[model samples]
Target: MSSENLDVSSELKSDSSFADRTKSVSIAEKTSVIAVEATSTGVEGRSHAAETSTDPLAQPNDELNKCVVVVNKESGTVCDLWDDHFEAELLERLKANGWEPGLKLVKGEEIEETVVAAKSRKIGGLIAGGGDGTTNSIARLMLGSDIPMGILPFGTLNLAARDLGSPLEPLDAVASLYPGRTREIDALELGDRLCLCMAILGVYPELLNKSEEFHGRNWWRKFTKLGSDFFKAFLSSPKMELSLGMDGTKAERVKSRMLIVVPGHFQDDFGIIPKRESLEGGKCTLLVSKHSSAWSLFRMIGNFLLGRSAQDPDLEVKSAATLSINALRRKKVLLAIDGELAKFKVPLKLDLKKRALLVLDPKASEE
Candidate 1:
């Protein structure tokens, strides 16, 4: 049978079981119960339960031994629905599959803590459950380590998960633990800081920096705000002079309204926008758009929606092994990496690390 047909059967069986489990409980209540039960069980009990659960995805495999799951509670509001019952269900699922699930809750500023916990426990694999920012945090901590990482989409954008074709359902995510495929994604290191997703300045970052309450009003409101923000940025025409390097080449000066370096493509309600080439083999992709005019920005948006970025001349795309950025002026620029906002500093260095991360991919062919 074809792979699609096989996957359909498997998906049906999996969905059936999930339905049975949650038939009597609302999604919110079930999640809450799972979290509470799992937490109360403590690490030892939870491990034991995972070892005995009947879920195929949780079944023990040589590849999944000593797996640790690190979660960021603030990743997405939807994750808030994940309570004790949901955790209990997950534990049961893992145990059924003969795997042990080690869960760790993380604080926003406690990236180091999560790393220490994973390392000290000799975890063979790490599961990052959060949004782009949380994924970035876990990836940063696990860099240089041999351990593989799993991406669990629990964010608004979920750019990485969409790119990887990972499972969206909770149990399916746990099942993906067995895929064992790894992709070497590019990362940008600004000075001592690292960014796994795109970094941006100009109108995009400003929209990101807005409070959730303001942007949460409605789709129309968000669109209006974005339009207004773009106009304001265009009127200001604020430009920053940057010294940049591509593929170990000598640094050159470029002035632009926005500079975006992305490790992978990002898709939204609009459509797919192709990103720079793969980051494998220790190379990073840089995209520079100098057009500050309102018309230029509108055309770029149209191009993105139409998936015609390759045909756009104003969009300069380059591949490099490393890039260094320095501000020519004293004024600080707004910076955002992986959707997190910050202030830009001069002399920022970004280099690609080859085969740095081992992430889970469900669509990968089985060995």
Candidate 2:
């Protein structure tokens, strides 16, 4: 199916968040204020009185008093951050704010079990200490539960955490969780997988698949495999028919080179990266590069640089509430969800779940 244009400006508005201007406030105030920001959309979906009404820390909220922090020790930056005494310092800081926070350092495979154990204890909140994948994994468990979550952002590219308004600094992020709010963010669903940021298809996934064949081989073998994979993917990338809507009415067929699907409210940095203004927005953007041409890649780059939406003949972008895809060849499609590669059976359906996650809200900064 061809990508159809949809309007999403109304869905891109910024929500209220804690402001950096109050940095000089007392430690208690810091806890209450950050919690106030987190619960900005209060129980009734209104502003919490804590913002300008009452002290959140003074309230007898058991959920806000106890917390668990999950660290992916294998993540690229976690070891470095932890070695610098980040955990001890944060624990001391949080304890001073009257929190009984616990820490759990786990390998990648142990993530699911750790989440279950934490939830079984009915912890007030969870703070993920890694990159997007780790954050996404933790979030999946917190869905439909009262357990709010926070992020430590130790990944190579913590896009999901950044989109949720988390700071890059470990100290600021930790301190901001003194009191946390439950935020419902839109999540993408494809089969059993949850995509927090974006889902990728086409040449990138093909290249990922090909490169894995030489993953443990020597450098020369990996380098040679990369080149070979690129040429093969460029020539052999499959054609697909994209169908939109739950009923599968809208359709377009393209000789796909690459396809990137992002939440309707993806973050915008005015850089080469794709921009979406709202995570709670119930919409998504489909960025498709047709014909698999090298020149189309350059055009995509230029469009991003110029802040122009993709509407050219070779490349186009569509924003919608949901979409579906089917391989014309009816074969397994290589897909990448939040940077992790996987294979999904075709005729895949994707839809958005609005405000499906809760996170510690980072305050707005003038900088």
Candidate 3:
């Protein structure tokens, strides 16, 4: 089988969670508003703005009385994560927890526009559903805004959700976030973009993600094509020389096959992606690799995944509040940002932004 593009949960437990609930109309169609069931397509919540105030954005100042649920239908695991009536059930859950709820099932391209429109409704909280990439997009969109966000892990890995102590199960996740409770968190800024987790620059992304499309037939063909690409990327100058500077210090030269940067350090040498120490630590850790070849790097990663860490000289971990990296020969480098692939310009700069986001945290309220 072609392995998953990123680490994901092996078993996606399908839990049964449902009850009667109320729904709101989309904030976009305020002129011709009509009552619709909570689960109706493109539906939103009971607009307190519509009934009480002339301005549509008449939201409460302190309490999160209303929430808009935005689900990216194209996310990898969304199709199997919930039932057809999930929208209704989710709205009901929010209602039971004292929230005015709205629902929008949108394709990937419509996510930003759909969300921005809802935010104009002055929603108290924005509950975003998708994988790490989708969550990353929403978090970036909400940055510097007063709106807090809640995450539903419906994509592969769901690393961001894991960091937030959210349940991998969809309903359990929603149930966890009490209506008004939220936690402030931080992020790492990459140029103009935001990274909630980590950014990796290395040969693996170049090798695996370079394929524009894997056509032909059968799983073996796909795996064979992948192996071929891996070897080619490996053989084509597997190592790159990089100049790194931390906290505006002078640059130092280093050779690496893979370089990993995290908003904070990853503690415990276990799991596919280990848990972070804290999200608001205001420090970044750079895991630089000196593994000689593709095979060696693979072994090192495998060791990490399998929960074994020997203090080998091949790996170095450095910490900084701000970092600069320049590849010696390459103008742009293939990168994995929160498990999504992109090509970043040379001289990548990274820094920490503390208390940048307020995410719904049921655990915090429960505590």
Cα RMSD of predicted structure 3: 9.2
lDDT of 3 by residue, 1-367 (tens): 1122222322112112111111222222222212223545442333542354322233444445777778776564555444436655776677778777656666667778877876776567888987777898888888877788999887656778888878877877887866668878888877656789888888766665656432111335545666566555655755789999999999999987778888876756577556675888888888887877667757765677765433545788898988888899877777778767666666877777888888888576467
Candidate that would win on TM-score: 3
Q: Which scores greater on lDDT, model 1 or model 2?
A: 2
Full candidate order by TM-score, most accurate first: 3, 1, 2
| Poorest lDDT segment (10 consecutive residues) of candidate 3 | 13-22
Sort all candidates by lDDT, best to worst: 3, 2, 1
TM-score for each of the candidates: 0.74, 0.71, 0.76
Q: Estimate, for each residue in 120-180, the C-alpha lDDT of model 1 and write its tens digit.
A: 5444567787766677777777776767777767665555665666666656766666523
RMSD of 2: 13.0
True-structure lDDT of candidate 3: 0.68
Name the TM-score of candidate 1: 0.74
Candidate 2 ranges beyond 4 A from true positions: 1-63, 96-98, 211-247, 265-269, 291-293, 311-313, 364-367
